[model samples]
Target: MTLKSVFVLTTLSLAAGCHGHDHGKSEGGKEGDHGHPHGAAAAELPGQSVTIWAQRTELFMEYSPLIVGQETGFAAHLTELPSFKAVTAGMASVTLKYVDGTTIVATADAPSNPGIFRPKLLPQKVGACELLVDVKSPQVTETFSAGPCQVFASADAARKALGEEAEAPGRITYLKEQQWKTDFSLAVAEQRDLQNGVRASGEIRPVAGKEARMTAPVAGRVELASPAPLLGTFVKQGTVLASIAPRPSAASDSATLAADVAARQAEAAAARAELGRAERLVAAQAAPSKLVDEARARLQVAEAHLDGASGRLAQYNANSSGGAAGRRFQLRSPVAGTLVAIHAVTGENIEEGALLFEVIGLERVWLVAQVFEPDLPRVQGARAAWFTIEGYEQPFVVDEKTSKLVTIGHVINPRTRTAPVIFELDNKEGRLRIGNFTKVSIATGAPKSALAIPEAALVEDAGKAVAFVMVEGEAFERRPLRLGVRSNGWVEVLEGVERGERVVTKGAYEIRLASASGAVPAHGHVH
Candidate 1:
């Protein structure tokens, strides 16, 4: 079996119990949905049917009464478990594993239809033992048990032993064939403790202290750096985005300031010379010490004048140069973020207070919602809140670990009668965009415990919300839902469904179509 599975699975053969999902486009009815029932292959039988579940396969067989030296036909409906799809191709063998170690095996090469396999067993001896259906294919090899079955001694004895079919009314008969071919799934209903909350309209925003506005510190012509920091560009703190060439003025002209610095330097040199001469004369007893002191003070004043002129020249020259300088101010990003806006352009001369650029950190964003004034009290005490955006069914949770409440406005809008409520959200996935409209829910009250299911499970039929609850392996019943609170992709069920009961979650539309047509496909195999 291992060697066979290795060769079959390695070849990736779809010829076994496995099949390609795409058969062809459907003609548009239940007949087209799961494939039309294999009516021609089915023939009526007298005895009861047995359905059993194995690790990987489900076998539902309808077989005739067993008797010695008599041939018994078994119509095996093989379905793959978990997926609930048909085992389209496989070799099915029905074997009677007797207590005394004797066995009778019947073999069918392939399914009469996709999920139907017919096998015949000739019991040479009568016994009470396990009925095992073994399916072998490149895709799967599984043996399903129908538990203990009987092989009668004679036909009259068989009639008395297998009495009569039980009364089966109002039991919706969905064949395993239909379930295997259609989109199908089941979800267990369970008790959930959900927080009660109120809904409000909201918008995504950049969090406070995460956004930085860059402006010109002095009146200058804008000069952009290499790879101009365009809108939507990510930048780091102190990354030079552009430079500003200060508009020259008469007082701060580079040439005039340079000349003033030279004159001041000359004055300082002459003062130093005079101070040296005064000190020499004082040492020779030709002048007073006060004259030397006065010379030293004059040199200090001249040097101070030189430094003042030099400072002005550097300031006007953009701090780079006095000899050849105009680019004085280097505009840099104040924070690490995406460059969201650019107000100034290259070579544009602007005032000192003119706006230049805007950068905003998008790693974390704020969800701002407006609550009705009457609902403001509840929002103010909210411990948790979440918001849903387009393209996402579940709301993003705003918790203390990744996010927190930023503020709840006390002031109410006079015209709209709403107050602003804000929550900081983790936008690490980059799903939340600023200015995006959203639906928000804030949990203000205590948690309410009740049975619930996924919001996707409910289907509207004839203006009533209904769910298909599984009754058996191949049966389902519709139950109208009595709804209560809904939050976080789940809806609270007040009535109509019990906890632990399974309901159709996926491929529910097929069930709806089946129910509406009132067609239970023929048991598509012979006994």
Candidate 2:
């Protein structure tokens, strides 16, 4: 016999065996038929009906009725694979096969409930019967079959038999092929030397000696130099910032000083002429040698007085000719930095030693933290720190290579009970602004190894810390975590996750939403 014929004969034999038992009389006709009296005679035949359950392509299928000329029902439950939640949106169909090599197809309809589909089937000749359920959703299409279920005399018997073989819940089977279609990425939990740190409030400041206040050198009217310096203007050392012209006053006026210098010059000229005359007379025996020597001494004294007056006037660029142009002194910057403040404006009369400009170098900065007295020892012993400036999203790091601990205040504030702890950081980028409030964490204690993951990898699920761990290429399991110290961008994982296991990092929140909603459309790809 052919293989097809042999399979048919075997199915027929099994069906016969199923109906062999007498339903009318148990053994001695002691009881009337309690099970499906309408099909009592058929139930006596060996294999009148059967029920079976099968899961195919993520849809669950249950089939009943193995005998010919018997009505059968096929129910299909559409669900997402791995997550087994009911998929309410889909189309399903059922195909029925008979022993006579004939087939019938019917569309499945949803009952009052969603995700549950029912297709009707009535066999004409029932040596054996088989069913195939096809389900299609927007994301995928799948086919499932429970080939040739044995038909029982009653529906109750079939339900009872199928219940024993039902699948377990909470197990999902996400495929690797589908994972690539969504925004999914993973990171491995690693053993790292994480620092336990203390958090403190602080502010960014210009380092001491790195800032300077330019003051008026003398009492004068301020005249801004060309290309006037404004607030935030960067200047170099010795760059002329402004000019201070001496104000004409009774005490010391430029015109009066000029007259005095002229008078002194005239006196020096007269003395030199007198000395020359005296020397010539002595040579001709017209005067005594002592008289010539005395004239020479007097000329020297006058010349000395003239030099003193000229040198004094030169400091103000003063012109003895009494020109206002030579009466001003140029004020230059003493340091290279940005002008943070301007105390005196152009044409303003400033007094001697008055504040004019404040220049501050920003290539380096100070983070001054107000450390509580209890934590002062930790702040002093900390090897490094991470600080966040106001208005910036990222934290700036300060380590031995780029920073140093400059001081710890000896006096604590009486009101706040806190002392200043200072750290210097390189600010070459100028991202840190002076006087801005900061949040600081100083790493303290000895270095110790601990399992940690990126802070981004953590998410909250029902108020518990959760992370997603990749069990397979595409399958992920939600893990509750016990977190320890958090330092820098990493958080120590005290429990729930293991070292070397890949966890979702960049898209952890996305996964959490998917797991919560039981529906995840295509997400962005992780590069």
**TM-score leader:** 1
- The estimated TM-scores of all candidates read 0.60, 0.48
- Model 2 CA deviation exceeding 4 Å by range: 1-187, 215-222, 227-234, 245-326, 341-356, 390-395, 460-462, 469-477, 504-510, 520-527
* CA RMSD, predictions in order: 12.3, 17.8
TM-score of 1: 0.60
**71 Cα displacement, candidate 1 (Å):** 8.5
Which structure among the candidates has the greatest lDDT?
Answer: 1
Model 1 global lDDT (CA atoms, 0 to 1): 0.72
Task: Put down candidate 2 lDDT per residue, 403-513, tens digits, no spaces.
Answer: 998888999999999999898888888888888898888889876889998776888888999888765333368889999988876889999998877677655665665
lDDT of each: 0.72, 0.63
Clashes of 1: 1
